[model samples]
Target: MIYYLFQWLDDFGVPGARLMDYITFRSGCALVLSLFIAVIFGRKIIDRLQMMQVGEIIRDLGLEGQMKKTGTPTMGGVIIIIAILVPCLLVGNIGNVYMALMLIATLWLGVLGGLDDYIKVHRHDKDGLKGKFKIVGQIGLGLMVGLTMVFSPDIVMRENVEMRNVENSEVVIEYVQEDVKTPQTTIPFVKNNNFDYSWLTSWMGRGATAGGWILFVLVVIFVVTATSNGANLTDGLDGLATGTSAIIGTALAIMAYLGANIIYSSYLNIMYIPGSEELVVYMAAFIGALVGFLWYNAYPAQVFMGDTGSLTIGGIIAVFAILIRKELLLPILCAIFFVEDLSVIIQVAYFKITKKRYGEGRRVFKMTPLHHHFQKQGGIVTALIQKPMQAIPESKIVTRFWIVGIMLAVITFVTLKIR
Candidate 1:
């Protein structure tokens, strides 16, 4: 809204209105405005949730201070959704395909998460929407994003390189061609960062292009489902999901900037995605909304994000990575979420296997989700790799995880330069 107004004013020779032409400037303004909205409206939203009794249903897992969090307001992701949408609508280019996709992703997952949270709260079922239902919703979103990227003429990239005509010893840096379809993505620790999906389908010979798109869609579905589930698992502690997501958002913002800029794209030897610069504005709002929500979401929380916030955050992170052609980097950047998810899987599988073998159920961790494992009861517990048997404080655990998230963010960036 404000962006269009300023853009029109700039055409009319209005002084300083041209500042809107710069992505950095608009992104900065979006950051500030989103922060203002989150801080200003957050309290009121919390109050409204309380009035509606949209409280978290806690199960006693024997972790320290676990019961205290019961009834804390959940589904606070609405705050983040509003903050992001408002800023993007005001400052982002409404016509940009990337912006359109991001907005759809934010709202789509938000509604799914909101429905899950609603079921948990009103139906008094801790297991909100059925697992199959959640998976279906994630698959739906992934398909939408994949089809859009494939079919939308606006969503295209140009491969850039410094071409050398060896006969004359002349070199020129240029984009290969106009926007066209390809399954190219960035791979860390490689001289040529761009990796094409068609290479994986080389067996298809002349039909490799079709096979590559199929593989790409499958990859998108997996990423969206896995990341969203990982985030939901990481929401075990106060401020854990919100804080970690903010860090990831900041990293994605930098990636989007580099991927969208022709000069940087050429320098980095990556795909140049025209109009993707608009994503920087979206990411700026994401970071701001998470930080501002943290004002009340910090330790000794005033509200919880519930599935609404957690799923939405994960979806945004996943889609952002996909858009920037950095989906491969997610394993490193989102290691914490993966660890949390894996811990539960390992624990559950171990328990079931042991029970089948010994005719008695055995445990792997005192609790699952990895974080809660650190917040367990002190006792003899049969588990693998239980060196740190001593219980750790929740606040300390959250802080340490945050530090890890930061370290991962740094390494994620450094990997691009490392190769």
Candidate 2:
């Protein structure tokens, strides 16, 4: 909104209106505005939730201070959603295809998550939304995003092509003059690493392109579902999910900025995604929202984000990466969320197998979700690798995880050039 006004004024030779032409300026404004909104208005939202009796339901998991978090005002994710939306709408290129998809993804997942939070808090349903319904919603969003990438003429990329010097066998990278539409993504640690989903279906001959897109859509569905659930599982500790998401969002913002610039992208030997620069403005708001939400979400929390924030945050990260063709790099950038996810999977699978064979269920970690495992004292549950004799402090665990997240972000950037 404000962006267009300044853009129009610039065309009329208005002084200083051209500042909006710089993505950095707009992104900085968005960051400050979103932070102000979240910090200043977030308390009122928390108070309103308390007035509505939207308290969280905490189960006793036998960890330190487990019961103290009970009755914390839940559904505070509305604060984050609002903070992100307002700033992006005002400062971002509202007409850009990438920005449009980001806003859509934010609102779409926000609603889905809000409904689940409503069920859990208002209706007092421990189950919240059904698993099938949640998966369906994720699948619906994945299809929308994937199909848009296939059909939208504006969503195109100039892939970096590699040239090898015969004299010295040295490799040089160059960009194509024309943009191309394809389901190609970058793979780390490999030369000429543009991996295409269509290659898997190139055997289809006449229908190869269509088959490739279908495969990409399936990948989208899986990525959205897995990432969202990973976030949901990681939300157990105060500020864990929120802080980790901020780190990931910051890395993504840097990636979006570089990928959107032709010169920077060419120098880095990566894809040049025209118009993805708009995503930098959107991600600025995203990082701001998460950081602001952290103010109240830190240790000894005043509020909980519940399903609303976690699902929406995860969806935004997944869709943003997909839009910028960096979805393949999520394994490194989003390692924390996936690690938390894998902990639960390992615990459950091991317990079931042991119970069936030995007539007694065995444990892997003292509790599922890797963070909780660290916070728990070792127990005699026939578990494996319970070496932490004493429980660690919540705040320290969160800080250490954040440091790891930063290292992973650095690794994610390095992977582009390491290839």
Cα miss at 48, model 1 (Å)?
1.1
Query: Model 1: runs farther than 4 Å from truth?
Result: 162-174
For residues 127-207, write the lDDT of model 1, one tens digit per residue: 999999999999999999988888888888998666889899886668977787898888888866778888999999998
Q: What C-alpha lDDT do the candidate models reach, one value each?
A: 0.90, 0.92
lDDT per residue (tens digit) for residues 249-304 in model 2: 99999999999998898778888899899999999999999999999999988999
Query: How does model 2 score by TM-score?
Result: 0.97
RMSD of each: 1.9, 1.4
Among the numbered candidates, top lDDT falls to 2
Clashing pairs in 1: none
TM-score for each of the candidates: 0.96, 0.97
